[model samples]
Target: MPRKRTPDAHDRILDAAGGLFDRYGVHAVGMQQIIDDLGCGKQLLYREFASKDKLVVAYLERCTQDWDRTFARALAAAATPEEQLVEVVRAVQTMVPGTRGCSLRNTHAEFPDPEHPAHQVSLEHFKAVREQLRELARRTSAADPDRLGDRIMLIIDGVYASGATLGATGTAEEAVALARDVIRIETSLPVAESEIPADVR
Candidate 1:
């Protein structure tokens, strides 16, 4: 009879892989590293994940779920589109750390072939994120939807390229300030048409 596998093998492998990928990127990590970190035999790891590509897809999916929850919660905090936009920026503000870069962007740069299993999964995750930003742009009254959407995407790319080494947390804050300015410049505060309604005085 085959020996029973450790119950925590799945999570431990993912945790080890996530730390390695987030810190050094997926390509930099190897099966040896995973096996060493997991302290498990090769067969056990294979039984759980099958392949590195499949495991990578799982990790990216976890990131996506986490981000979606954050965005949804922030959006739910406000009643108006403009307010929701600010909250969205605030949501992004919380995502930065000192070492690891954005997981999705890192994967995109590391995976050379678009058809690579992990690469395809990352692409889908990216599309979903971009679509979310576009929807945020539509909700934000201060900037034109398409243009602001493009600019936000650009800023995000810049943030990833900046990396922790360049102090990207400051970049996130600066981006928020810039976004507020963009909104202010494009949108005027709603004003009464120089006369009060008789019913409201």
Candidate 2:
């Protein structure tokens, strides 16, 4: 009889795939690369994930979960809706340093076909994040929450885009300040400079 597989086999495969996917790209990393990275046989990987496409989908799903958790943790200390909106920027700023770029954006870029499962996962993740931003904008009494959310999303996209080339640290700092300014303006709050770093002021 065949021996039983380890309970963590699936998770281990995901872990290896996630690292490779993030570092290189979904399309760039192959099943053999993952197997080599994990020092496991192809059979074990195939047992956990039936195909490369399925593995990519699983990797993206895990990334989405991680992003949600990180954003939630970053927003936990925010006391107001405006602050919560700003926290979204802060969350990205905090997380971008460790990442090469936005994983969702990268996935979307790599898999431009809308019908692709990985692309769909990326789209859903983006929509969910935007909805979260819109909810916060609504709570903040913005004149137009959807518009405000869209604007903030644009700023975020710019930040991520720049982060891939122009150094994440500076870009992230500027992006957070810009986001805070937008939130304040939309809410008719005073143009407070408290959140702006002294160097950037």
Candidate 3:
């Protein structure tokens, strides 16, 4: 009889691959590296993921799940939809430090072919996230929620890119302030004094 496989085998492989991909990027890492890092036999890795492309697709899906978690936390952290938008930017700002930026964005850059699975998955994620933001924006009193959503989306994209390159020194530090200002200006609501930075106030 064949032996039973461990329940966590797939996740273990994905976790290892995700770490490597996040650090060095998908193109730079290979199957052997993942195997070595995972300390699993070649057959086990292959059994779990038939090929590198499949593994990459799995990794990108996990990254999308991570974004979902960030969105949930941001959604739960604020009392108003307007504040939730800023919270999304704040959450991303806190997440991007000491990393290689957004994994999907990096993977999308590596696989420029629109036909590539990685590119397609990342593109879908972007579209879904944009729509989700627009939905949230519509809940606010902003005259043009779609424009507000796009501005917030741009802020998040900027935060991830800036955080990866500049750590705390770049526009990452300004993301929350800019987001708050954007919300205030777009919604015609004044920011609470407590929300302002001490130095700025």
Count residue pairs with overlapping backbones in model 2.
0
Question: Comparing candidate 2 with candidate 3, which one achieves the higher TM-score?
Answer: 3
- Residue 173's lDDT in candidate 2: 82
**lDDT tens string, model 1, 1-201?**
866656587878888888888878888999889899878888988887788888888788877787889789878998976656656665665665436667877787788797887788788887887888777778666546767666666666665556455766676777666655555555664534443467776
Residue 81 shift from truth in candidate 3, angstroms? 0.4
lDDT of 2 at 168: 76
Clashing pairs in 3: none
| lDDT of candidates 1 onward, in order | 0.73, 0.82, 0.88
Identify the runs in model 1 with alpha carbons over 4 angstroms from their true place: 1-7, 189-201
> Using lDDT as the measure, which candidate wins?
3
Q: Which 10-residue window in model 1 sums to the lowest lDDT?
A: 187-196
Selected candidate, larger TM-score, 1 vs 3: 3
Model 3, span 119-185: residue lDDT tens: 9999999999999999999999999999999999999998888788778446655998898889888
Error of 3 at 174 (Å): 1.5
Counted clashes in each candidate structure: 0, 0, 0
Number of clashing pairs, model 3?
0
TM-score of 3: 0.91
lDDT by residue (4-115, candidate 2, tens digit) is 6566998999888888887887888889999999999988998878899998888888878988887797678689878877777767755453356887788888999999
Question: Which one wins by TM-score: 1 or 2?
Answer: 2
Candidate 3 ranges with C-alpha deviation above 4 Å: 1-6, 168-172, 195-201
Those runs of model 2 whose alpha carbons end farther than 4 Å from true positions after fitting are 1-7, 97-99, 193-201
